[model samples]
Target: MPDADSNPGNGDGREADVVPGNQGGRASRAAALSVRSLAVRSLAVRSLATLRAAVDRIIPADSWPAGWEGGVAEYLTVDPISADRDLAWAWPELISLAGRLDDEAHRAGADGFASLDPAAQDRILAVVAAGSGARSFDALRRVCWEGYYASSEGRHPAGLDMVGFRGVPEGVTPIEPEPLKTVAPAVVQAHYDAVIVGSGPGGGVAAQVLTAAGKHVLVVERAPYLRNDQIRGDHLHGKRNAVYWPTVGPGPGHPRVAQLPDGDRVLDGTDDASVYGLNADAVGGGTRIWQGMAWRFMPEDFSMRTLYGNPDGASLADWPVSYEEMEPYYTKAEWQLGVAGEEGGLTRRMPRSAGYPMPAMGTEPSRELLGAAADRLGWGWGPIPLAINSVPWDGRAACVRCAQCIGNTCPVNAKNGSQSTFLPRAIATGLCDLLPDAEVIEVRDGTGSAGVTIMADASTSPVELTVSADVVVVSAGAVETARLLLASGLGNDHVGRYLHDHRTATVLGESEHPVKPYIGPGHSVATLDHVHADTIPWGGGVIVDLMGLLPLTSAGQPAPGVPGWGAGHKEWMRGERANLFGVFAMGQEIPLPTSRVTLAAVKDRWGRPGAALRKDVHWTSQQVEDGMAVQGARWLDAAGITDIRRQGGPATASAAGEHSCGTARMGTSPENSATDPFGRVWGTSRVVACDSSLHPTNGSVNPTLTIVANAFRVAEHLVAEWPR
Candidate 1:
């Protein structure tokens, strides 16, 4: 290990007091603002005192492998009161709640939580952790473990030697924050051919294709260009870092209010438990962080209402464009992005026009292990189709086989996100100018063109900037794109309507040796047997294998009935290390009219209304999701993996806060849809949306590739329509 000064906890000269923050996927990145650092802020004394006194009890030191490590509970304290507070402040609130509960307890005679004796504190905390104060307590305990378990103190704990759980966050490659490539407002000579908002899959491809067609393209992205240092794969940073760029991003100040059955509630962007509607914002967008599984929707996906016959209460409709028209673009995206894997014919899957640019990655023990279970159950499982490179294709390097694939930025630069795949080419063409951190607040109709008003690099310096374009393509995912269109007063009738996502059911289990889940990419193998099967009563889901969990993430999540802290929790962590497996069912939900995104009444920091996401997934979709759960549980049972429990409840839209679509949907008319078949806003030829919002239904597949393909298709129209 490093010198004695590095570790200060153990008596024999280990790291001292567990480093304030964690050494997650980003070990080399400079540490900043530990929970201890929060103590220096306002009300810091009471928060720190309350946290220090309670962390050991919430996560007892003796109960853990180490004798005592004191930094974790402190990691739970942050002061967001000074912040704009639109971000996830579960930590600050949890710490503040600790102070609140302590005050209440103090009034009842015990001084405070910190001053109370161990037994009394435990009694109060247990009730709070399991009762009305549960949200805060549970959040506190989780972050406490997120900091502790990922630390040097928690990594080399007593019994961990047998489990061989060293905690994730292995290597560290330092990188500067990606500088904002700003577009000088004075440089534009005239109205550009196109302006694309949101540098995600849809916009990235559209910009590339349009620029290649010799059109001047100005691409405005809302998030800063995050350098490698900014994106660490650590559970603390990648999984639990809600303060900034949580998988759902623009970290703070981007509020997405939800209209619920009870009433409209403004969502804390950071809290995973509460926020149902989710959208990702970034220079690279969802492609930057998504688990790179690029499956194509079946031909039936284009005509869901026709094929399935629209169920009552669900606002399903036929796409104006058919699968045949989209086929060439799909072929182009796969080849251009250098997708891997082979011909897919898994159960109810669709036929493809061509094979992948490269063959699937060489087989590992996971396929065979999961395949054996599939064989026993008569299910068809195979190597999952992936955008990740098996061997170096194009100029990018091959995947380094780092298990920390999803959510974490690729240190080796192998994962083919649209940001890396298309934006580079678009920029290289010299005709495309990308302005990162430019939040497009409004897109209005200019004289024979479209006008976009934005705050250039809104993160650091917010300066109002407006630019005119011949065409405007808003691709800020489903929610944000809809918000922009509504704010711009285009597509006001249908904008921000029909929101949906792959209502998923996570089935976590433990395998023996054949499946070393913490090895390769996040998702490598999957079964498509359940999807759209006649045998199944409802629409089915895809079951893909995952790269399990880090010790920090897994430690916080005890088995179904086990207590989250103490000896039982520690022992449970040991048995679950390599044995753990992630087999999840991504079920399709019926998109309802009520499940929509509207402009919130309150304005955000940008002076535009925040996105108001309202979800009411149909009951039949709930049935399908429930059916998928049982089907996935059976798959795990057949594999002899134990501790199989369904992660989420019935009919709930989404938990991971992503893969949402259908809002601002495409169709034949203005009343029912926001955009035309070519992604053109109804009644407006030049204005369009190129994101998942154009999708009328999110088929039983990931939508990134499809979004890219559809964008390619739309860009062709924009090219042909432009004055050559």
Candidate 2:
């Protein structure tokens, strides 16, 4: 047979360059028809050949298409290895690994690895997998699997079909993309009444309020306003996919240094899904791809310090403003943003002034089974409060109930976020100037007016410009907010202290019968029985059904003791796809003073220092998760689910995760907090810290809803007391 690499158009090597994203592999089959289209020039000819050979052997043609045919070669050459800054260090190592394979083939009396027969290739790969290069080989194998399973653009059909995924229904037409109308840097004015230095929930709400009040507002965002399709991707490459870089997350040119629990400092780029602290960086922030679990902080959540009494060195503190003050705003957010849920079951635990704007989503088999389990366990269960539309209420269509919901853009524009709800309204008022792709580096506190120095297109063709604003609201998330304040010589010593997020525990279970979890929203039912349990002292978290897993995600997660790759892993995936069910408990993370965000020594693409994060979760958080996990296992067992596997403990490693907040907490005094009760920085009169950075303590659920409610409160306060 002719060498595969030498003759690119050979039988097996025909489909080389067409790397498609995962759209149930239905559309990917057409995409993976050619290899010459992809830019293989960057990779050495010999190295590319070896990669193809290695991936083909790893997932050889066994009734299904081989790994190389599923666009694994393109995935390896085009994505993280060549383009990702965080993984740039691994490029040379990967190249070396490829070279090692070729060298091994030479030792076996072959011209190169690609020239070897299938059996010979498998033997060489097996030898490497068990030898010194095991780790590197494993990494290569992981990427290959991701490529084959995830599909770059829904081009690989075999992987999706193997897992029984019926791609987006044939007749389902996606909602028309509503692109943001933004102000170009060249046309932006010098000053505005108020400038919000972030476009997340906090900044979006602030803009909506300020703009509605007829105040000229400038909303500066670090990321570009991505269209609906751009964010949708091929379903497998969104915010939830941990291994691959997400669509809404920060891309190349952005980097951060994270200090691990073992005290080792590692350089991480914005694209490093796990290490760099993955959060949505686009206009909507985390809300763009959030699961839409709209939850309000319980009344008792406002007084963690008063209730818990600072146990186990946790720096717990009560919010300066109580839930009573925030209740109206929470209502406003739920109604204005179009939340869908029933208030009947939640009236006692989560007291609301008014009912949800829309009714709860229809019950499905998964929810019914879980609700039954909760009933049997004597737990209080209810429809999960969602910011997704159950009816066509807010000019957007209702959700199509697609399997891929969380971490993905809603195909129907039903999932509400800052981008979908607030920013659009803010822009329509003609008073808001939304500038996307602009990074506000510093807020210069002038004697007369506040000046914000912004870098337009910081990633490519950087240009620095200083624009003035009467009030500068720093709503740039917890970490970035602290970094900006620290870098600009603003805020007190208390800035960047007491960082935390919801300590989450994911318990996966396998049911004997088909639960059909991949039918609608990833999660449907939830139990709040543990939110403030009497048994445990520190307060437990909400136990909800976990998001549905994509084929790639499932492929990456092998059950404990199962091999990560090879035929055994493949068989396990095929059998477990329909049976697997997940339960997630989001426990409260006790804020610790030691956990913080500061400036890193490394510079970004624009020559500015990146943020340095050191996070430490309290031991009490572990106890909370342990309690939740036990309840979760019981619930699963009640539902006749077995083979339970629990993951996530203490949240020490994942403290800087999606819900990271409280770095610049608000309180009564500057001695204990970075900002005042009204979210105003203690020293800076016109500058305010909005966003979850002002969260005194993270609650026991997803923080986006609370962040939205608080942003409404802060924006109202600013509007009432604008410096005239």
Candidate 3:
């Protein structure tokens, strides 16, 4: 196929050379001819073929469409080469195994490796599916299936629209006449009606709403704004900023904390040997660096206690409000955050007053394959609801489907994170002020209220600025917010307590067909079937995008017998990019009182106590494990995968921290919780804790949307009670 760059003028030239054959004369003929030429050239077709060949080598033939030569391959091939390479390198042994399959197929009288009879194919593939093959083949197949089907072609075939396909929504204009180019001083003493700490979904939205309401607002962020030029494509470079500290396990520079086997006293930020998956010190916080998924928790997710009662040794309580109270806020978040999708679908149970502000983003081959599999299984599969624009909504352009949606911010303002949705609008209102590079040191109690003391900049000279407000909202995330409360001596006893995160594990296997896994979103389009169950006590599971592993990062995966690096490693690495998928379990963790985050002996660059987390997920409940197994089996069955193996036992340690929540929880009573139902701190009448810190219990879905909705609810209360 001709490269996209090489064929820039091809379409235009074809259009100009068409002969008139209709009543409309030259114009009509030219249009028809152009379309015919485009069909004949089949640039898209060839690209798809290449992608199919790559994916087929990774997954089973049953996981893909009947004819693998369709648009799935093209969609997979359209992604960035860097992403493709990363997906390929995750499973080195899969590359060698695929080669063996080819040789075996040739010996078995097959036209090509993937074209063998189902029984014979399973026989050869079996070597890679079980035992040692389980790890390599499972990883390759999962990644490839996810990567290919989640692409534009894959999504369309599977019946989902592309996100950010057109222009931004009508009437919502871009912030006109940009703000002053000069950076504001690190500290400002100007009094405002509201002061929001942390510029994530919670704070950003608060700033916009309060500012628009004519209240003077100030947004304080610990990190500076990241520019487009600063973004890196290389995984190592991305890791420096994206990955949490103490990159290597049990190494020096790792934060230390005490841990308990059972639920007892917990500390925040110090436990969990894995790299925490939170946002960097950037303007948008986690929003600037997160997978673009936006899902509303099920109704049962909100009221955990009312439904299942409380779990033994866990603080699993019902949310103060039901999903009904937050329904409008969900809509508000979707429209404001620029979600793209069909409102009605079997998987989508929420009621919408209006359709998506924009159409859905295009799908890739991986999504299509999964969709097909789901259809075959008679299961529900819809476009993964996302905070991405199909046609530009709220002034940002639609996504080009660069295939790097997870872990990286978009260069174009396609992904609707805090920066794209709220910061700009907040700044434009002029009623709001943002102070970047300002880190709050402590929240000292004043005569009646509390005053925030902050270190303005990185300069040697210490400059302290105090701001007293009638109300203070801490949206600094679960870890930072808990640390701040502890540092301030406000709720030190409960500050770092009840640290929790999703207990994640991966199930992998390989396929007989090409899956072309690196084409679109980096996560699964279809969630696992065992997500909902009121009677059964279990955390839910979701299908993840194929695990895209870069060469340097691939060193982390020992994979039982595979060597770190060698000639065999390099050969395996070549095919590793497009061949893996993991059924990632974002299982709800049973919050133990012992899990906590406390002040570490070590300090950050600002001399403030760095958070030391002490987490204990070693006692993950059987319910979670059962749920994971159920979903894992279903996903493998749908994908027609063999030789499946589950990584990490029910009580094993995990490597993710993005879904961590509930260090400082919200409840009706202060003795049982850290904050009030309105998110206000227990003792303080004015200070409120927003962010995931206020989540009493972490649900199975990504917490950002819920966080935003709760923030809106908090903002509404504040606005209603404001001294008008």
Candidate 4:
């Protein structure tokens, strides 16, 4: 019935199947598989069939009273995790495993695995689960749970009533993600007074300060500000859907060669399938997404080498600027950004200049439990400072106390992200050009003649432009910022050296009474009791009482070695969702030269160099995290938590968190660091490093406040020194 022009097909009177299938019933089989995207390849049917036979052993339906109807293999066939390279690479092996198991069952007097009794199937699975087959088994299990428990069927009346999960409230109407191309045009000018590479907390603050000082600042951001429309409280996209990270990006597929014991494994940011490093790409950087834990480093954090002395295999050094000088800017950030907290309990290394602009956010049941536990154990505990409006500051609405806040856009415009704060203010000043989807490939001429080569988002029409500026401020984040500098051959040898991030550990506690961690802000309580080493190792950090994870993350992780699908994990969440609490260690890591960020062999999406990050965490840093994890477990026990599960310690594998920093490190001289005391690149007069990269070492607390404060400090210094 179709026109020949519109419906071009073979003249054989048959339609061609885009899905290349292997058998004569290929068309029929492929159609069935297409519904669940199991038609990714010709062997998809065989792969999925093999998978179903194998998955039954790990997550058996007969094991539960009202069990999941063996749809786990279907979920595994379509879940995002299943699409990734880690699983895809092992998928063939898994298929082989299924065949081998079936063959074994045949040899053992049974027809096959599916025909064998449950006992026999599990016995065969046990060998695979214990040995190298554990890799494929764990991968299959993770996706199975993610798909099953993250579905409406899994969180049914039977389960939801048990867990008391109201689910993420759907009051705020969701909108489509907005790219601010109309309001903020992509018109690249010939020149400007200054150019900032990123639009994060640091870059946003710097833009506000510099533009207010009457400097024409051009802010280049690789990602568009998706705005409030992107917030849907969908745990699938916002939370543990990516396991260790949120579903954000480095934009245009910046690949990295992460050092592994076996060999170098290449990670392409553009290719979601092979994600090794995760960083959000947007106008406001991480501030648009972070939960906002605002805290200043203790005095000892600055002078780590001065106080503890640099240990073996560590690159510890004193910051050129002191906490005393940074205190004014810290106060400025707190007041200007509307941070809320009281200035008492667990005495700090130094006193605050003034109390936080607003009072602390309301507490949850976990806070009470933690305080009581701390009191009983004679350990220090207190409320954490938050960057949300307690009583509606700066015309932003007050927080509605949303449960899912971390790594998500604020549902009610209550959160204080840079996109809502400094960038807006900077734009209002009419002196800053906030250009989103502008990826800076490199930074050159660090002195009076500075310039950057930028390309529009690859998804759009390619518009490569070279914008020159009098000054260059690279705050593209620790990794990308360092990569740009290294690519341009700017600054000293330390340009890409000393990459670091907080070594974290977490303890999930199951309380006797319902604590209901989903009632308040995601991060409401923390204690600075252990700012420095009192009894632990050389490094010290704060232990915070974090909110319970969303159901998606919770389902995947119940206890170590526990099958994520079927009975154990789902049953645990049903009984304990309300009573779950976590103790998180946001601790420090000494800068190590070996843990450096360099240019990777593989090019980015724009044909530019990618980052080759070598993260060599010292054994002592692991010791600090291990010690904190041990103490956190003890605290949970003291609070009368019946069951506690600890993750991350000395034995845990090293992976980068959202807080990775300190590649283009700042110091006094070119010999040691990339930037000077005022954050100006040592070899250049005006070009500077303004983000957490300016930090000589990552302090125990979250670095957003410090990054912004330093940005303000550098802006002030530039305002005074530069010819305005």
Tens-place lDDT per residue, model 2, 1-724, is 0000000011111111112221111223223222222324434755587877787777777777778875675555443321232233344556667878998999989999999998888788888889998767866776666577764443554677777664354478887556888988888889999889999899999999999999998999988767776666354446555444455656655667778767645443323455566577777888787768888889989998898798867799999989999999999989877899987545567666898889999888778899888878877788888999888977888878877666667888888998899999999999999988889888976557887999986544668888998899999989899989998999898899988887667788788876755566667888877887774447788887766667776676666766677666777767755677868777788888989988888876567788888887678887887888888888899999888878634334444677889988999998888899889888888898889999988788778888988988898898899865
Write down the TM-score of every candidate. Answer: 0.82, 0.87, 0.69, 0.84
- Evaluate all candidate structures by whole-model CA lDDT and list the values in order: 0.66, 0.74, 0.56, 0.66
How many clashes (backbone atoms < 3 Å, residues ≥3 apart in a chain or on different chains) does model 2 have? 19
Instruction: Name the runs in model 1 displaced over 4 angstroms.
Output: 1-140, 150-190, 237-248, 268-277, 344-349, 510-516
For 467-497, candidate 4 gives per-residue lDDT tens digits of 8888888888888788888887877888878
Window of ten residues with lowest summed lDDT in model 2:
1-10
Best by TM-score: 2
lDDT of 4: 0.66
Model 1 worst lDDT run, 10 consecutive residues: 1-10
Minimal lDDT window, size 10, model 4: 1-10
Q: How far is candidate 2 from the true structure (C-alpha RMSD, Å)?
A: 7.2
lDDT of 3: 0.56
RMSD of 1: 7.8
Tell me the number of clashing residue pairs for each predicted model: 11, 19, 85, 1
Superposition-based RMSD of candidate 4 using all C-alpha atoms, in angstroms: 8.8
